[model samples]
Target: MSDPDADDREGSVPEAATPKKKKPKKKRAAEPSAGGVAIRAVRLSRWYGKVTAVSEVSLHLGPGIWGLLGPNGSGKTTFMRMIAGQIKPSKGELTVCGEAPFANPNVLARIGFCPQEDSLYDELTGLEFVSAMAELSGYDRVSAERRARAALEEFGLEDAMTRKMGGYSRGMRQRAKLAQTVVHDPDVLLLDEPLTGTDPSSRHQILDALQRRATAGALVLFSTHVLPEVETLTDQLLLIARGQVVAQGGMDEIRQLLDEHPHHIRVQCERPRELASRLMTAEGGIVGLSFRGPDVLEVHTWQPDETYAAIGRQVLESGMKLRSITSPDANLEALFHYLVQRANRGSGMGADAGTGAGPRLQSAAEKAAYEAQLDVGGGR
Candidate 1:
C-alpha cells in the first residue's frame, strides 16, 4: 500500500511537496459605540428555558426610525423586550443607551416601551393612565399630568383624553398608549405593532408623530409585519425571521442586496427564443431559462433589473416586438420567503450574520449553545 501511492502522496519528493494553504484570519466583531440615543446588540440572544426566542443577533443603531420587520411569532417582541429591560438575554451583550438594560434603573428610565398587547387600565381615564405613566418616569403630579395632556393631544387623543379607557375604541386606546409612551419623552422608543387597529386618520397622525420623534433624534425602533409601513416610516430596515436577522438596509442598500440573489422574471415578447438566446449570453448574470409559452420565457437571473433592462434594449435594437416583463417575486414577502428558504437550505445566509453597521464575526455567544437546553424549545 505504501509503495502504490507514495510518489503521489509526497509529490514525488519532499522538496517538491505543495505548500499548504493558510486559513484566513477571522476579523474581530467591532463593539458598537455607546453614546447618545442608540441600541447595540453583540450576538444578543434570549431563551426561555428550552425555547430559543431571539438567537445570536447583532446590530448597531443610532438615533433614527429603524423598522423592525418580521412576521407574527418572529421573535420581534422578545427582542424588543430584551432591549426594554423586561427580559434578560440568555447570552450575549446588549446595551441600550450604553448600559445593560435588565434591572438597570437609569437605562429603564431612559427607554420607552409599548408592548403589542392591550395594557391600558379599563377604569382609568386616558389622561389618568398617561399621567401615571409619566409619574413612573419620575415626574411629579403637576408636571406628569401636564406632559400627559400634551402627549395625548400630540397623538390625536384630545377628544378622548377625559374618557375612561373602557369606553375607548381600539384606535383610541392605541393613541392613549402612544401618548403614555411619549409622555416620559425617553430617548429610545420601542413600539411593538403600534398601529395594530388604527384607522387611516389615526395611522397618519401616529406615523407623523413617530416621524417627528425620529427627526428629533430619538432612536425609534418599531416592529411590524406590514412591509409598506416600514418603507413609509423609514428607509432603515431590519428584517428578521426564525429569530434571526435575514437582511437589513436602506433603499439603496436593499437594491444592491437583491443582486446577490437569483430573481426569476417572466418575459412576454413576440419572439421568445430570440430574446432567450440573446439573454443566455449577456456578459454573464443569467442563471437559467425556461420557456413558459410560445411567446414567454421565464428567466432566472442574479440581476433582475439589469436583465430586464437588457431585454428591453435588445428588443429595440433588433426590431423585435416586446410585450411586457414581470417578476413574480419582486415584492417584500417574496424576498423574505426566498432568503429564509435559502438559509434553511444552507446557502450560507445563516452563516453570514451581521449588521452592515457592524463587522460580521463569529460571536462569542456561539460557545453558549450549552445554554440551549434551558430554552423552551420553540422560538416565539
Candidate 2:
C-alpha cells in the first residue's frame, strides 16, 4: 500500500536551476502549499496488531461531497476515526485545516464528525443532546439552543427533538445524531454510514442537507457501501478494497479505466455459420463460439484487439454483413467483480466480503431529482 502522505512529499523535491548558485537549495514551490485545509492525509495508515486496518492511504478532499466507498473491513471507519483524531495511525501524518487533528482544539473546533456507532446520550432528549454538542463546539448558550432547533427542523425532526433518544426508533436516532454533528456549523463534515438504518425518506433528507452544506462551502465527505448513492450524490469516488485504494476519480473516468483493461470479448453478428467458420479457420482460432439463433453468432475471444480486428477485416474482405458487436459483459458491475475476485485470489483472503452492497434504487424524492435533471436536458 502506498502512503497517502507520499503524494505531497514528492512536491518537495527540487530541480536544479538553470543558473548555478552558491549552494543548491530545494525549491519550496514544488511541494503543495499549506494554509487552508479541507483535509489532508499523508501516508496515513492504521493497523490492529497483525491485521492492518487501513493501509498507507493518502487523500486530499476539497469543499464538496466526496464518497468514501468500500466493502466491510476495508478501513472506511478506521480512516474516518483517524480524521477525527480519536485513533492515531501507526505511521504517516494526518492534518485537518493545516493542524494535527488528534486532540487539537483549533482543528477539532472547525470539524464535525458523525461516527458509525450510535453516540447519543440514551438518557438525554434529542434537543438536549444536540444542545450539548453545540456547546462543545463553542456556541453560546442562546445560539446553541437556536441552532439545535433549526437543525432539527431541517432534518424534519422538530417534533421528535424533545423526545428521549432511548425510546427513539433506529431511524429517528440516526437523524438525531446527524443533527448534532452539524449543530455548530463546522466547516468540515465527516459522516460514516450516516444513511444506515435510515428509511428511504430519511436518507433523502440527509443527502439533501449534506448537499446544502457542501454548496455552502463546507468540505463534506461520507463513507458508504452504496454504489448508486455514491454515483448520484457525488461525482468523485474513492474506492477502497482490502484496506487499499483500488480506484479513485470521477465515475466516468473509473469506467474508462475498466474499459482499458483486458477482458473476454463477446460479439454477436448476423451471420453465425459464416463468421464462426471464418474465425475458426483464421490464425487466432476462436477462443469460444456458439450460435444462439439462425443469424446470431456469439464469438468469444480472450484477445479483444485481435478479435475485433479479425472480425472487422473479415467483414471487409469476405463482404459479410454484420449486426451489433457488443461486449455483453462490459459494465461497472463486471469491472467491480473482476477487481474483487483478483484481490481475493491474490491475497487468499476469501474471508473478506466480496463487494459492498449497492444502495437500493432512488426513493420518490430521488426520482423527482432524476426527472428534474432530465427536464434540464442533463445527461445521466
Candidate 3:
C-alpha cells in the first residue's frame, strides 16, 4: 500500500485533473543564512547496522538557543551526537562551524557536548571533574581550575564542589555535568536532557547560564521531552519525531498548524450550568462540553477567541462570579500531541489504531522498543 503521508507533487496528477488555479507553494523548512549558519545538515542519516537511529534529516541553525524538542528515542540524542562529532553519519553531510566535524580536532575543540549518560569519574570531586574537563579542552592547570571553579559556582555547585561525584544526588550530578560542559566556553554547545533530574532553582540557574551563552553568540542546542522547559529557554524550535524533522519554526508557526484541532478551555465559576447554557445558546462555535464539577465546566471550541469573548460578556452581564478561565491547549505540549496524532493518521495509521497513541505514551513505547532492540543487539 502507498504511504498516505507521502507528499503529492503537482506533476504526479493527471493533466486533465489539474486545477486551473495555481496552488500555493508548500513552505520549505526553515534555513539559516550562510553568513550566520552555525550548524547545517543535508540528508543526514545514522544507523546501527539493521536499526536506523536517525533517518534522512536536514536542519539549519544559527547562533542562538534552539530547542531540539522530541521524546526519548525520537533521534534527538543521535542527531546531537552526530553534530558533536562523536559519531559519523551513515549518509549525507553535516557541518559545525562551517567545517566537517568527525575526526577534526579543530572543529571538535569548538564544540562542547554533555552526553545523557552519567560518565563522571566517581573518584573525582565535583571541582576536580570539571577542572579535568577544562584542562582537556586545552586550558592550563591554573586557568582550568579557575574556570572550573567559576562554572561550578555559576551552576550553584559551590557548596558541593568538594563532594565526591558518587556521593552527589541525581540533581547535583546533573549540575556537575553541566558545569563541566560549559567550563571551556566552547562556541557550540550540545546538551542532551540537561534539565533532567534538576531542582527548580537549579533548572533556573542552568537556563540563565544557557541564555547568557546564546547572548554571547554561542550556538546552543539542547534536547528535552519537557515542553515547558523549552518554552522557558527559547522560542526557536526544531521538533523531531520518528527520526524525522516533523516541524521547524517558532511556537506561533507550530500553533498555526494546530488550528484545525479543537481548543480546550476550562472555566471555574459560581454558575456553571447557567454559564454553560448561556454559552450554548449564544454561540454555535462550541463543539464539546462537559462538567468537571458543580462549579466547573470543560469546553472545547473551534473558535477560541470568539468563545472567550462571549464568556467575558456573559459573565459581566449576568452578574455571574467567575473564578478563572484557562485554555489547556494553549501550550507546546498540546501542539506536540496534535502534530504527532496528525502525522500518525497521515502515515496510514488510523486514529483508533495501536500506533495512534498520544505523544507522551508513544514516546514511552518508542523508548522501550529502542532499549529492547539495543539489548538484543548486545548493547551496541
Clashes of each: 11, 6, 0
- State, as a TM-score between 0 and 1, how close model 3 is to the true structure: 0.74
Clashing pairs in 2: 4-43, 4-57, 4-58, 5-42, 5-43, 11-31
For residues 1-380, could you state the per-residue lDDT of candidate 1 as single tens digits? 12322442354423322232122243121122335567777678787888877877766677888888777666889999999999989988898888999999778888888888976789999999999998788665666777788888888887889999999998888888888888877788899999988998888998898888778778889988767777677877777766777666664455456565677888898889988888877744788999998999899888766887888777887788778888866566666666566545655343153222233454456534422321211110
Report lDDT (Cα) of residue 151, candidate 3: 85
Q: Residues 113-222, candidate 2: write the lDDT tens digits.
A: 88888656889999998988987876545556767887777778989899899988888888888988888777788899989899888889999999888887777789
Q: Which whole-number lDDT from 0 to 100 does residue 138 have in model 2?
A: 61
Higher-scoring candidate on TM-score, 2 or 3: 3
- RMSD (CA, Å), each prediction: 20.6, 16.1, 17.8
lDDT of each: 0.74, 0.69, 0.75
List the candidate 1 regions with Cα displacement exceeding 4 Å. 1-34, 258-260, 264-284, 289-298, 304-306, 318-330, 344-351, 354-380
> In model 3, how large is the Cα lDDT of residue 370?
32
- Residue 211 CA error for candidate 2 (Å)? 1.3
Candidates sorted by TM-score, best first:
1, 3, 2
